[model samples]
Target: MFVSDSAAVRRPRIQSRAEATILHADLDSFYASVEQRDQRWLRGKPVLVGGGVVLAASYEAKAFGVRTPMNVGQALRLCPHAVVVPPRMSAYAAASEAVFAVFHDTTPLVEGISIDEAFLDVGGLRRISGEPVEIAHRLRAEIATKVGLPISVGIAGTKFLAKVASADAKPDGLRLVEPGRELDFLHPLPVQRLWGVGKVTAAALHANGITRIGQLAELGEPHLRAILGPAAARHLFALAWARDPRRVETGRRRRSIGAQRALGRRGRAPEEIAAYLDGLTDRLGRRLRAADRSCRTVVLRLRFDDFSRATRSHTLLEATDATASIRHAARLLLDTAQPLVTERGLTLIGLSLTNLDDAGPRQLTLPLEPRAENTLDATLDDLRRRFGSTAVTRAALLKTGEGLSVPLLPD
Candidate 1:
């Protein structure tokens, strides 16, 4: 529909510092950086955050190929001299809040993608905030001083290029993709740099002798469609041609709440998988309740070692926010997708709830076995709210192993 908001319209040109608009901000080696900032001994050392797994790696560690979600054993093999630290999520949360405060200070139009990254639209602030490049410079200084960590930022005409620029400007750097230079900046990059073109997609592109953004851009839409499927081919072609038009939207309602974990390798028992699902369901349910939302559709996602992923979902007759209902539905979907889990092993599992509505008003009449007793749901929620999420517990969940249900953060 190509609808445009007249109020936020920006010129299609990149001018001096006073005229730039879109800005992409990213925290550099976020988790590990936080650890280093908090502990004096860790600075300038290769730091890996996590015990059995590598949740994040410092830039020093990354140079040795230590990456997130890889097992600790693998990370150690890659960076034998790395200093490992357990994750401090509460500290990270506080740091994220401070960084976001700096972002909001820059402008009101900020879109948060995650706790560590966001896009700020400062076009409308040109008259009030001087130059965009100067603003980014100030933002970097503010973060380094106040937050005690390094951050990188990118300024560009479009969100996609801004993100690309941010990636290119890593480890406490800033890069601006000047308007009219987007193609020059994007086309020479490897095809893997394109969003959604993971290892599987890249291999498929390579099989057809397509390895660079320029190559992908040269294949006309019809040729791309014939080689890849309609949807992916069309999207890849558009991205290859540097045609991303997504705007920096703020105040957009979140459509879903979800959590996922990489399982990696094979030989996992069904019980182990069930426990993982239980932990994810608990997190999703807490997020749903805290948001005061309920959903009818429960979706389960599974990824095979071969990189094939499958998703199954089922819609309930009535909306509910109870953990039991969400987990029950998720388990059903997991069971149905079991045939896809080969002996070779699995790589990832995820859970999401959609078709959301505000938590429905309590009904007078209900089935004998409803999702939950309204009185009980209320009591538990109040306790958790007044105390902490751990104030109330499910006996079954208490049996979870350390690695099986490591709590990343409270709801």
Candidate 2:
């Protein structure tokens, strides 16, 4: 319901400082917005993506108290009239690529936080692109005109404050935090509004009768440290004072690649579970090789019927992108946790490849023998790239369909 494409909201402009050139641009309910954008009937209606695990919810659905990762049963109970749709990861990726194209055109310095949001440095762009707020408003307009999706933008002196301002301007709105008033804008928010403050940290702060950012600032670094250890206290206190020195950076690749599958409460056999793991490993290996990267650690994650979670991991002797190598380590980790899986009844299973490194050329042996699996990997990848992902599927996944291919930042 926000002014998605309206230029009227640009009134009452706030003064800008040289330091307030960072802009945080975020898509409004990215996946759900994509759905609504594509289907006219879904516009202004409660829509939910991923029935099993609420991947994304439209603003209309959120108004009914439907939060993502919530079970569909609870979400439906919250709003029985809400429409459910399966995820179209391909569509989301296409949209992301389009949006990123816009981002790159906007500024050379773009730090992508995810597929849907990024921080842009617009300090030097004042003469070319007008003020930071003007650039943000035009950026939103261009995206709406070109991509037919809503976005929110925030302008501030620091990355932390910029990101927080973006959240406040949801569903196609824009906000700017002027200099000298950063504390005035930041201190009134809840303690959890700080970057790294999660449920556990928030609970700790609440136990100490602190709920707002101003209270945390007034508590003093020494007292805050006593409440939340030294490292966390230092980080939160700095954030409380709106002190973040990070600048927008480009070409920063992810340190890890991961994917997860959510299964209904119905029990799954060990082989069936193994099949799911195989599909996940295959897809992840393909993604790693596609990104031209390698990983040295395989992590296995699980969520049980009781909603309890567990994680197991194995480190490899060397980094490799081969599906077989990654799957071997993943299977080993899963095998070690077999007892827990059996006891707890797994409802969700996931795999993460960590300790990632660029897949640079390696030294050849004296005989100059090449790995046959490497050729096989290249061949399969070529085929899939030429055709579609379904062109080459593992025999193990014939009965068990390939798990969902969720969208992610470039690998």
Candidate 3:
């Protein structure tokens, strides 16, 4: 059992400037922790957070080999007594915010990989913090104290080492890769730990008598490039030797924002389908605004009940983050893809904006006919932002109307 010592006093340690100290923090059993925090009855039990698929399973559930994205039926077979709860995305989002507050307190140069995990550049704070190991320890203690959950902290010379260290320090532990020991620490690890070494890659490496990071690192760049291609091979080779040079870029603009939905066993009316389109478009537009980027193209992705997939995209004459523009463009793409949608029972729909750039004030075209008023977009955006994303919606999404009305993401 991993007992958290939140009140333990920090022991001082000496440090050096040559050491590269990156911090990786990952919350332990995040969704399960949220469940335990909200509902007292769930504590100390095997908990699974999902219905059709296992989004997350508690450590207690891990004894039965229930992992994420496994079929719920399979998970139940493994852990018959597991307490299953439908996911509460909003709760997870809130908890992620709370976790980020702690990360920001540690350093401003934080690279958020996801809502649950992030990389912190503590190199800037070394002078004030005493030692990076001490900082990692203090971070773990603070998270356990304030969030009512356990987090594992990893401090290492690079991002790859930091991530591997975090994995080694799972379930409320801290692991640090000391300076001048990068190779000694990494070489003994399995080759699977090297970035880009998926099951297939590992199998290939294993067949070549390269089962450890050291063996993979021993191969020349040309050898890896021949086996794994130029890009993946180079990345894997560098990571195998613990050589990552990427910096923690904070406050960087998002590259893209998008939304997706799954429609169960769809035998839907055209109206219902249109409603879903509107809902997805609205969600994407809001994300664009939130990220302050506008896109020149809207893509419509559809997956059939039989698991067949098709995509359609349309480029706009001008970039815009306005919901009306996005919705209109997306609908056109959806119309073009109408044959694929009706041919197979639609199972999923997704909307994405590409060719993104920082949003600027909308420009008026001089020769084109007067554009329709964009009041609806502004009004809905304002209403959603103020009251809630669901407070105001287009009439097309009414139950009686043609829209699917699947839920939308926050504005």
TM-score of each: 0.85, 0.92, 0.82
Candidates ranked by lDDT, best first? Answer: 2, 1, 3
Model 3: residue 301 alpha-carbon error in angstroms: 4.1
**Residue 13's C-alpha lDDT in candidate 2?**
20
RMSD (Å) per prediction: 6.3, 7.2, 8.4
* Candidate 3 regions with alpha-carbon error over 4 angstroms: 1-17, 199-211, 264-274, 301-314, 332-346, 361-364, 367-374, 394-411
Q: Model-by-model lDDT, in order?
A: 0.79, 0.88, 0.77
Residue 324 error, candidate 3, Å: 3.1
Model 3: lDDT to the true structure: 0.77
Candidate 1 clashes between residue pairs 3 or more apart in a chain or in different chains? 17-131
User: Candidate 2's residue-wise lDDT over 75-190, tens digit each?
Assistant: 99999999999999999999999998999999999999889999999899988989888899999999999999999999998888899999999978998998878888988999
Model 1's alpha-carbon lDDT is: 0.79
- TM-score of candidate 1 relative to the true fold: 0.85
Best by TM-score: 2
Better of 1 and 3 by lDDT: 1
